[model samples]
Target: MDIANSALRLAERRGAAGKAPPLESSKAQVELANARIEARTADAALEAARRELGLLWGNAQPDFESVDGKLDALPQRGSLDELSAALGDAPLMQGGRLAVALGRALLEVEKSTRYPDITLSAGVARDNEAGRNMAQLGVSIPLPLPTKRKTPIANWRRA
Candidate 1:
């Protein structure tokens, strides 16, 4: 918008000096009107962005009249290599990696659970009338049941 306005102003000055063609001056004016409309649209978008940001921060009203910053003064961006290196340690990327690791660990645990169960028992029975004691020992192992498994989890259990 600033660039458009500047061009229009330059055109007006040149027109006043009788150095600009009438058609060029008219085109610049039209361009300036379009730029104004674009600027309004950009402002509305910025306001919406601000409102969304406010909502993210738990604010119902975003009252700032204007954002304060110098776009040109921002530091030059890093190279893709630098950005990619940073991503390896970024919180969002790390969180995703952590989630994947957690899923894998959970899958391992679920697989382990599907392994056959082993049970061992020992007991002694006393029969005072018979004047004797009997000892018993037992072991039970359960085989995997395919009928009870379901969907994707079933595949892991089989594995």
Candidate 2:
């Protein structure tokens, strides 16, 4: 807009001095009008962007006037080593690591299921009518049946 305004002023001055044709001033006015329209359009876009950013922050109506930043400035880049170190703490990387740990834990649990569980029992009973006390003890071990255990592991892998 500034550029267009300057151009229009220059054109008007040249026209008044008889150095530039009348068409030059008309062209400059048109350019200025176009610049104004573009400026308005740019403002609308900026507002929309601000609103969108506000929505991301859970705000329906943003109270702030304008965002602060240097549009033309480039962000500083990190060194390879620094970036690599940071990658370990990245959300996606951490998720992957956690998933691997979970898979291993699940595998260990599944492997354990292959073994039978042993049960130990002991009890004492007193009978007033018989005037006697009896003690009992027993041990039992469950027999694991042969079944397809790979299906669950395969499902986990697929997931």
Give the candidate number with the greatest lDDT.
Answer: 2
Candidate 2 lDDT, 63-155, residue by residue in tens? 888778999999998999999999999999999999999888988897787578888999998988999998989999997677765656667
Q: If scored against the real structure, what TM-score would every candidate get?
A: 0.49, 0.52
TM-score for candidate 1, please give it: 0.49
Residue pairs in clash, model 1: none
Task: Quote the lDDT for 153 in model 1.
Answer: 61
* Candidate 2: clashing pairs of residues: none
